[model samples]
Target: MKIRLLSGGVEVRGILLAAVVALGLSATTAAFACEGGSCVNGLAYEAFGPAPGTGSPLLAVFVHGDVSAGGPADYMYSYARQFAASRENVVAIALLRPGYYDRAGKRSDGSDNGRRDTFQSSSNRAVSGAIRELRRMYKARAVVALGHSGGAGTLGVIAGADPGLINGLVLASCPCDVPAWRASRGRGGGYASQSPVDYLSGIPRGTPIVAVTGSSDDNTHPELASNYVAKAQALGLNARLQLVGGGHGFSSGVGGAAVSALGGMAR
Candidate 1:
């Protein structure tokens, strides 16, 4: 696996829980005009297994981190595809953050703010909106979101501010403390983005959250996630930190850890 620096993207009930563990999925994408908050279907995604409203119990959403301006901005395809392939009753969607385009050239609406001033409210709102729309579309019993790098930062905020939208969260190599990260990057004033740690009070205590970081990752260091998880625990949230062998990019270790979290949610 090619490891890059961290950067950084669904449902169901009792019957659905059974569906997620047993596993077979049918490829599906039932199109519809859906809106979440004010984004108004501004996001785009690649879906796998069971069309919307299929009664799938589990919905997993994958959001990739900041990729430079180029091809493969939506690089979570393999991860989402494999996730869907492993479960029959689950639907996985690899979402494109605002202003990002997939390999096939499908672009999501909304501004990426040059893709640097990201994880801001607008970006966070759009992502939360996308997840809301996806959940409604899938009629899922539970929703799990897996985000990496900048994507993880976004999900972290959503997991707090819009806590009701997701049941489980997997954050990989997250810059959970945005202000501190900006300070380290020499941006003394900090960007307009909202840090995940600032919004932790809103997350419910029962929500399952996990932050995974590479043991040797120089970028978005392990302490970022570890500290965030620690604070979360202080707030009585079910959160933990997982350290694995690798540099700063997504790996099979991160994927397995995330899938394991999803399984735990099912129970």
Candidate 2:
């Protein structure tokens, strides 16, 4: 396990390499929460802002997609940077280790043979730890969680465990039906049964959540994103789904739209 402290470009490179290696056979985890320190085996995250002096009441926590940690081409970071530049406090967090999606148990055929059923729970725990740490480090007027793909699932877990920790949630390209998805993947167990929608259903009304997905994201379940929005609405929570352009990965246009939506909610 290797940790990269936020500092110069060289350290970022080394940390990225370590994250890639750890994500072997699993999804890559990247976290950016607060700014400060370099602990052994633990990377320090920093927030970007305008003029390095102005501050805002909103703080956004961004979780990266599968096998990705805010590295180059990662839209999570791009949007976070944009928000920070606009004067919103933003923290990005990478996972402690690679996530299970990128790497599952292998089969003799040399294909991706790993089981997707059990990975969701494990990833959820990892993301929860990061969230707790970020909350402690930064006490903002409002907190929003932005997750894409596998990261969105992880955020669901966090919201289920503690809904008050974040003021709102944004799930992009998320597969809502965990049991069904796992089954479709040819795994015996159904989609990871643990989903935020299930837990948030009972929360008091007025919870804010937004689900976003691309019209072309074929990798995820067809109705999962819409289902999430519907569930949130049934619970009397403030929820909506946005349709964007592109596949699974982040695109500039989609990222901008997400950032805009988040800003609206934060205000």
Candidate 3:
């Protein structure tokens, strides 16, 4: 892969290009819209905390699970609001349309529609842009990323693009091998052969990461979180794994724990 060094760090632009080619994704498919308290590109992002006041330490970017954006019922907004209220700059992003992955007979394009792939590709692009904007506009000292399920993979892609952009990551109930899951369901194009695990390998050491999983989360194996932690540890990253007592849905206590863990890292 082609590697370009910038400011003493390697930029894996070629890896992203290869990933796009392997997934059969068009570079132009990722579009964005930021308006009226909503930043909806591939994902819906909302910023909080006084519009980047005079001095802010960092910006926390949140990525929600497989759902559209709304309010407290929306996990993305919930976490973003929680962090923002806790004196941290925050931005919440919703990356998938409601029921985008539902295999039931509810799609307008029938069962053969390629919705998941479209959603993932678009979300990744939007997140990349959001990170760039956060750094430029807010002068964020570091970026703390919080992602759930498929959103975790989107964060993984952004991490690959600019590892230095992220100072900490919180992954809740993430499906570690998303590309494999998509392939098993014949949605192979959603991810490339180079998985997020491979991408994490290149991240700088001491980049703190927390992998949270539900003890009863059958949808995403708890082992998946452990695996990510293990990989991060192998790469010399400051990574930790936690198991909360709940399913895929977020619990009040678990959410607080995740935010606290990430906050400590950012500080």
Q: Tell me each candidate's RMSD, in Å, in order.
A: 17.2, 12.7, 15.3
Which portions of model 2 show Cα errors greater than 4 Å? 1-46, 50-56, 68-75, 88-119, 184-187, 190-193, 202-204
Model 2 compared with the native: what TM-score?
0.66
Candidate 3 per-residue lDDT over residues 1-267, each given as its tens digit: 676878768675576677778556543222112223343332334566756554755777766555433222244565676677777445433323322322211111111123333225444555676677656766677787877766676676567556687777887767666765554445645343224565787667877778888787766667777877897788788888999888876563456666677677656
lDDT of 2 by residue, 4-72 (tens): 566674443255675676776354112222123511123223354422223434567776655434323
- For model 3, the superposed segments whose C-alpha errors exceed 4 Å read 1-44, 68-73, 88-122, 179-194
Q: Model-by-model lDDT, in order?
A: 0.78, 0.56, 0.60
Q: TM-score per candidate, in order?
A: 0.81, 0.66, 0.68
Native-to-model Cα distance after best TM-score fit, residue 196 in candidate 3, in Å: 2.0
The full ranking of all candidates by TM-score, starting with the best, is 1, 3, 2
Compute the lDDT of residue 255 as modeled in candidate 3: 62
Say which candidate scores most in lDDT: 1
Better of 1 and 2 by TM-score: 1
